[model samples]
Target: MAKVQVLGTGCAKCGYLLKNAQVAANERQAGDVVEKLDDMLQVHEFNPSALPALAIDGKVVTVGTLPSPSEIRQLIEQSQEVEE
Candidate 1:
């Protein structure tokens, strides 16, 4: 299964992003595990100052904004393609 990580400080925006990401993954039928990281140190480790970052399979895919359902689906597809 793919591993998805959302990095943020547990703010509203962060929560929204995480929810959106989860929706996207489900829509795409992606068999991935989604996790939320609210620690600053973890967010920093992702090398993004922005509050809401999306990572798929250990690679950062998005930051600073909540992706739409279509966008999230695209990301999931791309990640799956890369894995194959």
Candidate 2:
């Protein structure tokens, strides 16, 4: 299974991003582990310019914007394929 990490500061946007990511993962049947990191330090560990970032298996994929459900689903699908 792939590891999905949401890096944010616990803001409304951050929560929305996490929710969208979960929905996408479920829709895609990604079967990934989703983790939320609210600490900047931890987020920076993965992405130096972290701000509402999404990491799949420790690689930064999305940052800055809260992606739409469809976009997130595509991302999850791509990540799942890469894992396999």
Candidate 3:
């Protein structure tokens, strides 16, 4: 399973991104692998210049803006591939 992490400050966009990430993961059958990080300390660990960053397997994949569900799905798929 891929480890999908959403890093944000618990704002609207952050929440949306987390939901989108969840939906994307579910679409890819990775729903149970998604995690959200709203704590400033943990979120800053990713060093995102913007809110709502998406990290897969501890590596930041998207940052600064919200990505579409399909886009996020693709990212998750790619991460899975890399894992294999």
Candidate 4:
């Protein structure tokens, strides 16, 4: 299973990203753990200041912007491929 972490506080964009992350994971049958991480400690690893970011496993993929659903799928695919 992939660990999909959406790093952000309780912002609307954060919520939206969390929702879509779950959806994308479901569509891919990736068994991903899609979650919102409000902890600043983890958030700072990606960007000390970016409100919303997406991470696959422990690696940050995007910062400060929402990714298209297709882009999310591609990230998942790439992550899984690396695991294989």
Off by over 4 Å in 3: none
Candidate 4 error regions (>4 Å): 47-49
Candidate 1 residue spans exceeding 4 A from truth: none
Error of 1 at 50 (Å): 1.7
lDDT (CA) per prediction: 0.82, 0.82, 0.86, 0.85
Worst 10 residues of 2 by lDDT: 24-33
Q: For candidate 4, write residues 28-81 as lDDT tens digits.
A: 885778888998876877773567889998888888888877788899889889
Point out the higher-scoring one by TM-score: 1 or 4. Answer: 1
State candidate 4's TM-score.
0.86
**RMSD list, candidates in order:** 1.4, 1.6, 1.3, 1.6
TM-score of each: 0.87, 0.85, 0.90, 0.86
Pairs that collide in candidate 1 are: none
Q: Order of all candidates by TM-score, from best down to worst?
A: 3, 1, 4, 2
Give candidate 3's whole-model lDDT: 0.86
Select the stronger candidate by TM-score from 1 and 3. Answer: 3
The digit string of per-residue lDDT tens for model 2 on 1-84 reads 677788988988889999988887777674767889998778878854748888888888998888987897778778778878
Residue range 1-84, candidate 1, lDDT tens digits: 678798998889888888887887787674767889988877788887576889888888988878986787788788889889
RMSD of candidate 2 to the true fold? 1.6
lDDT score of residue 11 within candidate 4: 93
Better of 1 and 3 by lDDT: 3
